[model samples]
Target: MKFSPLETPLRTIMTPGPVEVDPRVLRAMCTPILGQFDPAFTTIMNEVMEMLRQLFRTSNRWAYPVDGTSRAGIEALLCSIIEQGDKVLIPIYGRFGYLLTEICERYGAQVYTIECEWGNVFAPEEVIDEMKRVQPKIVAIVHGETSTGCMQPLEEIGRACREMDILLVVDAVATIGGTEVNADEWHFDGVIGGTQKCISVPSGMALITYNDRIEKVVLSRKKVERGIQTDSDRSILAAGKTIISNYFDLSQLQDYWGPRRLNHHTEATSMVYALREGLRIILEEGLTERFDRHRLHERALIAGIEAMGLSLFGEKKWKLPTVTCVNIPDGVDGESVRHMLLHEFGIEIASSFGPLHGKIWRIGTMGYSCRKENILKVLTSLEAVLVYHGVHVNKGEGVQEALKVYIEQSKAIGAGR
Candidate 1:
C-alpha cells in the first residue's frame, strides 16, 4: 500500500472521545523539548500532578497521567492492584463496564459481574446489594458508559464501599472534566480519565489518581517485583508476584512522576504539554461553570433532536452530558445518515456498541467541540441527512427548538447572576 503525505479530514469531531483539540493546547505541545529528568521538565510534571488533583477533586498525592490512552490507566490500576485469585466485583451496565470485568479477569481476579440493561444505569442501592452479597475485594465500575450514553451515580455506592471497607475503582474517562468527578468526595480509591474527551487534548494520555488504600495494595505487589529484580528473599516473593505488565507498573510509573524521578520510561513530553495546557484551561474556566456549559449544550441538542421527530435512547436522568444516543427512525438506515453527515456536511457522529449498532446514533458534545454553534450545525446537518434518506423531518424546526432552549437557559443564567 502506498500512502501520501498526512492530510486528515476537516470534519467536526462529535464522537465520544478524542474530541476537537484546542489550538492553544496544540501550540503548547510545540514547546521545545526538555530532558525527562531536567529540572524544568520535572517542574512541569509536578505542576501537572497538582492540577490533576484539582480536576479529580482529590487531595491524593498519587495523581498523575499514564503514558497512553484512557485504557492504559484502567489496565495499570487493575494489573497493579488485582493479585492472583483476588475477588473483584464489576457492575456491567455497558461496553466499558464489561471491559473492567475483562481486565480484572485477565489479572487473575475472580470476577463477579452484575448486569444492568444497556441504555440504563444501576441504582446505587442495587450495586451495594450485589457488593454485600459477593463481598469482593474491589468494586470496579464505569462512571460514564459512552456506548450507552449513561452516567452512573457513584456517591451512594461510594459510601457503601467505605462502609464495607471495599475498594472503589472508577473509569471516568468519559465523564471526568465534562461532568462532576469529585474522586475524594465520592470515596473512589482509584479513578482514571482520558485527556481527549472533555479535556480536549490529543488522545495519548490517561489521568489517574489513587488513595492510600489503593497505594498500599499496589505497593505490596511491587515489592514482589523488587524481590525478583534484586534477588532478595524469595520467601517474601511467595506472598506476591511481579506486576503483570512492565510498561504499566504503577509503582515504577509513580516513582517516575514522584520525587525520586525514577526513569521508568521515556515520558510523552508533547502529550504532557498538551495535558498541562488542557488542565490549565479547565481550571481557568472553573469546574462547576464548565459542567453547566456542558449541561446547557446537551439540553439544546436533545431539544433539536426532539423537534426533528426523533427520540433519545437512554433515560434523561441517567444520560451523560458529554454523549447522547438518538434512536434511528423507522426505515431509515443509521449508517447511511452518519455517512451523509460526514461526507456531505463534513460532520462526524458515532454509532453504538454491539446490539445498539445500526439502531442508534451516538452524538457527542464534549471538550472543545461542545459549543452552541456546533450543536446547531450538527442538528441542522442531521435533519438534512434524515430528509435525504426519505425520512420526513421539519427542516428548520431543529435549530429553532434548540435556540429556544438556549434562550431560556441564557435568561435563567442572567437572572441567577
Candidate 2:
C-alpha cells in the first residue's frame, strides 16, 4: 500500500480519556523547540505552573507537571511515600483502583483493599469504617473512575482520613478539569491529574500536588544509602536503599523544581508547550464555567440516551459528567456496534474492562470534545448503529431528545432573567 501524507480519519473522540485536543494547543506544539534549561523555556514552565495552580484551586508552590503520562505521576507519589511493609488501604471500585494496588505492591507496600460494585462508589461511612478497621498509613481512592463512569464523594472521605491522621491520595485523571475539585478545600495530601481528559491536550504530562503535611512526612523518613553520597546542603536525604526507581524519584524532581534548579532528566519540550497552552485555555475559560459546560453536555447526553430507551450503568446521582457508561441492549453485540461507529462513522467510544467488558459502552464528553455538536453527532450515529445491530431503538429519537434538552435549557436560562 502507498501512503501520500499519512492521512487519518476525522474522529469525534468520545472515549473516557484523551478527548479531542483543541486546535490552539495543537498549533502551539508546532513552534520551534528550545533547550530544556533555556531561560525562556523556564519562564514558560513557570507560567504553566501558575495556570495549573489556578485550575487545581490550590496555592501550594509544589505544583508542576511530571515528565511522563498520568500513571507516572501516580507512581512518583507512591514510590516516594510508601516504604517497604507500609500499610496502604485502597478502596477499589473500578479498574484504576486495581492499578493503584498493583503499583503500591511493586514498591513493597502492604496493600489492603475494600471492594465495591463496578458501577458504584464507596459511601463515606464505608470508607471511614474501613479506615478504622485497617488503620493504614495511607488511603488511596479515585475521584472519578473512568472504567465505571462514577464519581466518588471526596469531601467526606478526605475529612475522615485527616481526622485519623491518615494520608489521603486521589487519582483525579478523569475528574480534574471537568468537575469541581478543590484540592485545598478537601484537604487531600496528594492529588494526581493528566493533560488528556479535561485539559484537551495530548497525553504526555502528569500533574501532582502535595501539601506541607505530606511534604513533612516525605522529609522525615529520608535516609542515606550505604554507597550514595548525600549533599550536606540538600533538604531531602536519600533513602538508605537505592531510590525505588531512578526516573520516578520525587526527591530529585523536587529539587529540580525548587530554587536549586538542579539538573534532572531532560523534560519533553513539545509536551511542555502543549501542556502550557492547554492549561491557558482552561484558565481563560474559568474553571467553574468549564465545569458547567461538562455538566450540561453530560445531562444532554443522558437525556438523549434515555430517550432511546437505554439505561445508564451507574447511579444517576454519582455518575461522572466526563464519562457515561450505558448498558448494552440485550441481543446486541457491543464490540460490533463500537467498531461500526469507529470505522464507518468516524466516531470512537470505549468498552469497559474486567467484569463490564461486554456489558456496557462508555461515552465521554470531556475537554474540547464536550460540545453540543459532538454530542448530537454521536447520538445520531449511535442510534443508526443500534438500529443496524437489530436493537429496538426508536428511529431518530436520540437526536430529537437531545434537541429538546437544548431547547429546555435555553428556555430555563431565558426565564432566569
Query: Highest lDDT: which candidate?
Result: 1
Q: Lowest-scoring 10 consecutive residues by lDDT in candidate 1?
A: 233-242
**Candidate 1 wrong stretches, greater than 4 Å:** 1-4, 228-240
How high a TM-score does candidate 1 get?
0.96
lDDT per prediction?
Answer: 0.91, 0.88
Candidate topping TM-score? 1
Please identify model 2 stretches exceeding 4 Å from their true place.
1-4, 221-242, 415-417
Error of 2 at 310 (Å): 1.1
The TM-score that candidate 2 achieves is 0.94
Question: TM-scores of all models?
Answer: 0.96, 0.94
lDDT of 1 by residue, 277-357 (tens): 999999999999999999999999999999888999989999999999999999888888888999999999998888898
Cα displacement (angstroms), candidate 2, residue 350, comes to 0.4
- How many steric overlaps are in each model, in order? 0, 1
